[model samples]
Target chain A: MPLFLRGVALPFNKGQAPDADVLAVSATGPVYIPLAKEEADAPTLCVEENSTVAAGQVLCHVDRLPVFSTIAGKFIGTTMVNHPLYGSLLCAVIKPTRSKRVETLPPVEEPDTDTIIEAAAQACIYDELDGIPLADKLRLWRMAENDQAALRSILVADATENDIYGSSAWCILKEQAQEALYGLQMAARALRFSRYHITTMLPRNRRRALKRLIGRENVFTTGDEYPVTVYDDSRDDVFCIGIQACAALSAALQQGQKHTHTILTVAGDGVPASRNVRVPFGMDLEEVLQACGADPEATVILGDAMTGVPCQNTHFPLLPGITTVLVMQSHAVRTPQPCIGCGRCATVCHAGLLPYEIVRRLENMHYERLRYLSTTSCDGCGACSYVCPAGRDVATQVLNANETRGTIFLNWGGVENE
Target chain B: MNNITAPHIRTEAASRHLTRDVLLTTLPLCIFSAVTYGVRPVLIVLFSILSAIVSECVCCLFRRQSMQVIRDGSAAVTGALIGLVMSPMVDYWVPMLGAAFAIIVVKAPFGGYGRNVFNPAAAGIAVLSYCFPQRMFTYPIASSMNPLPTGMSVGDEVVTSLSLAAQLRADATPSITRMQLILGDFAGPIGATATLLLVACAVYLICRGTISCWTVVPYFATCALVAWLFPAAGVSRMYGVLAQVCAGYVLFTGVFLINDTVTTPRFWFARLLYGVSAGVLVMLLQRIGRVECGCCFAILLLNSIAPIMDRWSWYVWRYVTRFLRIRQEVKAHE
Candidate 1:
């Protein structure tokens, strides 16, 4: 493949308060915690309806993975709730009580690899972006130690915020650099990888703070490009975990805390000011919007502008792995016109695939030709759609081709192909 | 509330905006043509634009497409291109005929706008040149042309001039000075002349990102290379290259036709190859073809091979890399 620089530099619009201190929003009302993991089979519920449960109490289990409650309250009857990434899921609602009932795993001092892995499993820690349970990921990396793969494995803490209006990851790295790096080092030690790096898109001065915390060489900076952090490097041996997940892992091992609270960047034009806010999982979207002083009439997106899921209403609960909550006014939808063949889409495609050509083949149902064009190489960054003069969803069309072919292509390799 | 897909935001430059930019870039050429060849060329351009819009509307009605299709302004650009390629001395109806053929035959029949395989403007100009060779090739002397309103048809009082391409084909040294050719003081097509203005417009378009420099640079380089390697009789190699580049619709074709987004290859390497091949073909056609200018034919031919070029260029790169890798493995083993 031609080694052209792929990915577009997205404009930063973190609104008026990108550098503002993070606000902590406690759940004032009932929080609905989804029982099943995103895209996974339904988990078995272990709690009874109307029973009192302490915070960090185990509520459900998907095989070996445990799902914990984020609030100490009465366990209400289960109900179907709309999940931002996953569709409607059965959730157990917990109304916060004044009682300070809490449950947490015992903290381990200078924990070894087995102790860290057990603590991660008990704490229900997950990689914030990939939605994969961290304990299982550790097991897989540990297994890979015996494999004779030529590429050396490395651990990476991805602090690069790919969202156009996201600053949560950056804020986490800025405030919790010590804990994040410590967590990364712990994971690397557990995986038997000597090299670990932290990647961020922060400006030089801010990056200097991170570089100071974890020696200058350990912190690598990338441009403010969308999907830059997501691009799979030529060597596929690198294991990536979100910066927030690193912080959570650190908290779980050091403070004996549960991975419950998530830091999210609440931004867009509809809010009075954009700020990073830490809210517990299962909090209502309405409460988050109100905490951010957002306009209720504006459209609420669960993620950033590009590749975000638009919420139909504010009734849905905030789910894990959500880095941004954009409250912006709805723009007038333009009627899509015929493709003028401007090639603007091709210019912004980071995968080096001609999106317009793939779109043409898709329109003609040329499935074999689409394969020849490496349709699966598309990571669906949505840059092609953003730059298309014709308002065509070129990225979505390639994604549809992938769906039709039953291929689960990620960056370079697919689950089926493997 | 709009339930749009992932990208809720879009860039400001839509298809209409691009078309407007293109039209804006051609304004300097139009103004220069009006000053040199009088108001007749401007009138031809306006008439051609009107004819194209009308033809597009008719085609839309017949094809049951929305009237909003014309709002993209592609037909206007096509019409302007068709008029610019015609001689300033042709009858007013000649441009109208060319515009109609461009829209109805070349553009709309292939599902309109971006779907057309061949560039409508180049195809239209080619058809006009084929059917009306006398009107298309003949040009009035720029110095003798009336500045004010005159008869639409070629008047007997005006003196005619031979184009530089025809002179080169006839194996005669150009009577015009090098400065005159650079300044476009001699007779040629309406907009293809004004060599300095065309160069300025090309630069502006490239800087504004309305056209790709990948295609434009390689095309001119190849044309200059070919012309220098085989200079015309009685002319120096450098002058031959300059004359070939500035005269006979060469610069105009490079600026507008070959760099067209719809007909050209999308990949950079394919686009580079397309430009070089187009330059070579235009030179060959100018040397032996019956027409005074062969740019339109070359563009049409290049347009047909663009998809194949896009596919093969990728395969070639892949094979070359694979070959290099295998050779490196052998070297390391040895």
Candidate 2:
């Protein structure tokens, strides 16, 4: 095993190893799908209120990207909901009706590069892990490869599941290994990449099972650290995609289906046992928690425990790209304290940035020195805050410094003078 | 609902837990000192702790801070450290005044607890040593068992003697056995004399990760190197190394004051350099300086320059990496 100099060895929460079967969770009430994707232009609504709409029908358009609905129902008036990525987004509320009508794109049997890209765009397949549309990522990769002929691209299916409490990627890879690998191979062949690999943090038995499906040489097992999959596009020639995205792509191209459901890992102290469930888009978060045997009154977070965003309103509808739901007791969260300068924060930082020093400089308003500290390298993994004895929010301080500087120091694979 | 940041979970050891661990490690040393000096050291330590708490409480109230700041137990640690470094023959007022000074002058004004740039205990002991050099350097015989209520008067001829630090400054070979040195049977500061117990405490703190070995190991190694290269007038090289390590506040400061989280450098490389330079400074002060509290002064001096050292170390790392990268590119082209 290669030694990772940074990152903390967080304790894996007990009973977090979800079962291989993905339980299907349907909406018990009206589902709300956000109209706008994160960082995209404001979407213009196309459907009217109370209009009969089928599942997999486009309801709005943000720039050239289309937003699809997963529920076959009537389009009630739009309501404001707290979006997981973009705060306070206008969502189209759809009341479920007794219609079985659904719309899907034509399956491409012999998909080339353009056909796959067009299929991805039509199916509304977004890489939830990378927070980018699949079609755009494909186009960008093709453009880069074409620009530099010597730069060989590698497609990496990132199944590392770097979070301490979630196993959505692991469960998906275990149950649908063939589909995930086939999706990766299809993308690599279309993009004309040199090779493709699947990286996971699974144990020996699970990894061996995956190795059996895809040849053993194609799988790479990384260290089970909190943040082993930080992607740097400027420096790396590798094109990374989440494992669930690959599975979605395969479903879109092979089964002639739209990307509608997401695999979510529901696990925390509030639940009796952790389970991986296939939650359809626009499902209520409260309904998903109740179905997973979690208390509705408990504090609900919409991602993994380390980097998850806490849900302010449990009534908020589930959105795509949200992989984990951490339902923790409200009392389990402790109040932050002042820094004691133990240096444990610096020791556990995966980016090797001095979090305490950054905090000190920020407090003193020493903005000039922060650039030299390389605050932009911080990936906000929360490892520093996890290991801090003082309970100080050192990770947030470093991230805020990154924002204040407003400059990302990209490593372009060359030496730069200080 | 609590809308906290990410990392909803945290490690178990908080600042209070770390302070409790440090206090627990000092218990053995305190007990050993009590047994050696017949309750005099115990009274001094308790009084010092009491005064430090009272002083911090007053400072907090005056500054309009919350009373919860006192619950961290850092004040008591500083007090215990001050008491440990003092001569057991001194009156209760000595330790009481030192603890008050440590908390009020060195700690609270700079912002209590984690924000203090200089270590309160070291600064307190250094101030006391400067004010009362005659009373501070004098030590009663080890295991004297004289628990007299009144403080020992200056120029009293009842078994009072020069401490090992003073003897070394006067250029005389210490008339002590290796066993006595190891077991702390010689006349020195109350808690600092127990070389064996202090070593065990250092090991425990290092194991618990409450203290860094990067600071402690390099400190002792540099001191040993200096002592080996230049032995005292009458002692052999090996004897000088052992005597210098076991004498005065060398081991005590290495285990406690220099390893203090707030005053020391944050990065490991800077800490390594701090330890090495502190060792050299301590040795130089012991050989040439007039004061007997050489370790305390050495720690204070290093604490002042710690931030600069941290910044310099970063620059050095950057330059070295850039140089190596350029060399690599040149080799690749060739």
Candidate 3:
């Protein structure tokens, strides 16, 4: 049996927004503001680059994230109401004052060492050294050393005041005092490597676009302004119908748009300054990694974390719906080895259907579950793909599901409310 | 100190992904079926697969769920398995119905694919036995042999072979050669002919890492052993093990049915358990129940208990290892 399952559950129908009406926040483009002082779900990715957004665009993706854009240009600014748990945090209304151009904000690498250290300190907390054993921690605190792992720990402590015990930090063990000093130094160096200011993206015609993407009935418009459209391909339709669908990735790209939001993650042991960068569409992937101080010889670019769309070029266009171009220093981990049939692929499926069963169905051509299993419901989160010990390309199964869906939907196209 | 902590390396044969491998392994059987039953039977089997595919697909639609993966090869495999056993002209609906039940209820509901605990073919046959027993058991038609009876009672002793027919008519056993039976020149189900062919396919399955030979060999051996030892509790021990091995579709069931992954044990020992028990059951059922079609029962019973047998084997192995270790420690002290 596979380890993961494409888990399935009936959609929570009550108060659940229709599939067509919901608008999700793109971190690169949308800024999530709040409505009247209530704790909200995450804000919608409303307002395109130059277009002014209105107040009624419903900002949300399925069940995750808050709704409400903060900019009141042509639309109402999103805000949070009262909440018992995050009562104080609800009243926070952050304005979208940052300019869209790349040259507007100061570069992250240009920040001073003290400011970097201070920012790290605010985000991280250090552990007290009194309780640690001498044999374990003695090598770290005693020296000004150049060991990368020890240096990393010291910098982590100086920046965030945390202890690095059993982790990848042990890879660079060396002289003691130097390790601590080097750790702090490395943290400051890492902090100085950020290339640009990261921001959430909001489509210009948020409500109209959302309505078009989700369809008008799917969008549940409460008292708040929702970015929506009616879904018939129209200029007034806020949604951008994807030009071409990549079955491998579950998301469709927004057509006729110059830039779109994509997931960004920096990986690789050789990269000392790895960070997440949400780059614009058509931006070179290699350039983003280079900006984050990535070592190319030791890198392997994975298009999506779930299913890596590997390209030799670092400068592949940043396509919308492609999660991240993950660069792993250890490329030896991925190999087309045999699956042990452990069923790990079946365990992590959010769809509630076992992956092994799905695979078996695919193999047997059972077509029963294959036709009715709702291949469209899959979000391709890759939880099932990640836990596989054999490291099979589980997302490929999603692709298979897509291919199978084409035939089934066509065959049964006239059956009912397809 | 077994050093069995983590990173256990396996051959990595994917259960669900092994469809191509399995098809490769079972290819020879398909060839044999085509050759023995000719184009008509093969087409019937194909139609059966198409029917299974259609039936399961319809079920998925009724459930309002997508059963898209059902078209890959599972429904086809189920159809082929049923096709191999059908009489070729035995109403296309029968095998299709059987395949549908096997995939949806037995295979899909239990989590489809690797999650099924029974051999899909075995389960389908079992259900088919209950639903359309006559259709499932009616003998196949052959060109080399004479035509079948126009109408006969379901349980009547209608000989499947012309030689058997002649012998029964003449009140004496006819001269049916062992070589002919082994080579599958005689009339039988679409899947029954080419006994050697099924064996060849079985060998490929074992070699390609898609099958476990341990279960198949022992399963045949045990059946042969029991058949030779107990030929009806004092009835003349006329037929021997080799005779029984080559008789009817025993070889077909041994190679294909007994080795179904989901129905048999994953562990080698549990497989032996399944085989031995099935062998005993087949003989017992054949002798006591006086049923000619004992292979279906034997296989289905074993399929039902395969997971249990696996658990039992695991339990026994665990205890046996612990017991031996205790004995070794006592000897060291002494």
Candidate 4:
């Protein structure tokens, strides 16, 4: 091109600030303190009764939940402290509500271990007789639970179970199922199998317990022509138990259910003591921090000591994407060093481009030549930068060299940190 | 509202950067061309580049668009390519005029860059070869061999043509040493003569990731395909492909010129078509017709029909897809 053409400049990235009012100075610290084991012995009282706090500044924060501020303040703290998405609220938060005043539990809705185990055992017996994935067994169990709901659910969808269960390894197990009994009454059936080849599972022990309790052969584990006995008198109750067992069993077999409520194990040497406590999903980290008594300002929120995203704020919704939220002092700022021409970029590039030569091109302002070298083909897997002996931000540099577009969102020009 | 980018970087893959890399890749050639022929060719390239940019700018202005042509590095490339095809020792003003004619008439008037029909450089060379044969080949080329200490020197004539080597084969003269060609001990184009220099630039371009070896490999392979099948070098047919490739700019131009994404065919078969035809052209021009300047002319001619070939092939593909769909529907009905 003739020397007259000029290039347009793109806007640079501007990160967020601290708790110094959004309209005013953007504050940038997260001063806080981790609640220690020794703190249990101290006369625990509200630390921040009412005080405006800076980013990471303590507003009666602690590692555990169930605590309030002795001083007066608003909170600005990260929530991920070892446990992601939720907090493990061990102690009382609302000053231990009077147990006598609050009456009644939420109705023993799902049943305890023994009854569940009994129902679960029945479902397993049914499974062994048919050798099907839990979903199929649940379908039959649900039909037996409420015949009206079953007809509605099945008739609303005209496709057959075979069609739904595509040809997969699971189909092999499906073939072992007893033939479908599609009359006014489904037939009682069981799969034929030689018993006890693989021994000492739950069936052996549960059978012994059930026999002792019911006096008759109450357990249905054996392939005795019919895995389930049709008891006319107790039909509804039996169906209920079957449905309960099926639901519980299906939940267990699910492959991809994520952790909603989790136990935060705060037991690192860096932490005061190792202890596990349950926390709800999406609980604010400031609430847990106030409970733990850590200075949010000094604590650096690390998702993990290894691979973690560093950010200044914890007000963002907690996501399962993070693993750990370590609280430590921030690392010092670093400047990039010039490439020593060590040829490390060349050695590590998977596409096999001489990236050092590429750097030379960039240095020489030959910006247009990068493509023929397969620079666009770079996957940005970070292997090159991760292994770079010079520790140059090689990955970041490569990323900077390429142009790609992503979704856009609102940025109310200079959003003041709250 | 807000735009965030991880440095939304443009690929050199665009005509812009591809054009720039082509310029950079051909820099040694340009310097060699200028030095050998004197700065007349350089002046011509400079004028054509300016004219192309100006014409593109004028079009962009009339269309109320930003002039992207210059930033894309295409106009400069067209100019340089024209400069390469022209003779070294022409009077300074002729190249400049040819460049103006090439850019204004061949490139910009037809919507510029990717939109142009004919190869701008080739058209310019064609025009000049007809208009001024004296300037293009005044000095007997069989006598320009002594290497200048710096740039391109025009002293007493020397047997400098690489075509001389091709022509030498019939006369049973000892073939020009491969080392001399590769290392550039002999003389030819300011840029294209040194097989090694071209290789180094090609390697740099390939490593830069602008061009793929797919086009490069296949183009030469197609050229060699015919050569290989009929042993022209008196060796085994397999070795004929290598011999044909190693000789002259067949390898360099096959990898670079015929492989140009914008002008060249895109689909492998279409590329094969381009390659194979170009191969035939090169063979006929060199061995049969005995045209000294075959590579550039073959490429320019083939480039003219590349789009039509691609479109025709795509039409065939679409027809097949539609036919299959209809057949499936008929079977279902039955």
Candidate number achieving the greatest TM-score relative to the actual structure: 1
Expressed as tens digits, the lDDT of each residue in B92-155 for candidate 1 is: 9998999999999999989998889999999889889889989988888886346634576776
**lDDT by residue for model 2 over B206-253, one digit each (tens)?**
899888888899999999999898888888888778888888688888
In Å, candidate 2's interface RMSD is 1.2
Q: Candidate 2, clashing residue pairs?
A: none
Error of 2 at A211 (Å): 3.9
Model 3: lDDT of residue B315: 57
**Of the pair 2 and 3, which is ahead by TM-score?**
2
Candidate No. with top DockQ: 1
Candidate 2: which stretches are off by over 4 Å?
Answer: A1-4, A14-17, A36-54, A57-66, A74-84, A88-93, A98-107, A110-112, A143-153, A203-205, A212-215, A229-238, A332-337, A405-418, B143-161, B318-334
Ranking by lDDT: 1, 2, 3, 4
User: Which of 1 and 4 is the better model by TM-score?
Assistant: 1
Instruction: Kindly list the per-residue Cα lDDT of model 3 for residues B77-181, writing each as its tens digit.
Output: 776787677664466667777787777777767655545667778777766766775565556434544333323222233344432222222335435566765
Off by over 4 Å in 1: A37-51, A60-62, A143-151, A212-214, A229-237, A406-418, B1-3, B144-149, B315-334
C-alpha RMSD of each candidate structure in angstroms: 4.4, 5.4, 20.8, 19.6
The order of the candidates by TM-score, greatest first, is 1, 2, 3, 4
Candidate 2 DockQ score?
0.57
Per-candidate clashes come to 0, 0, 126, 85
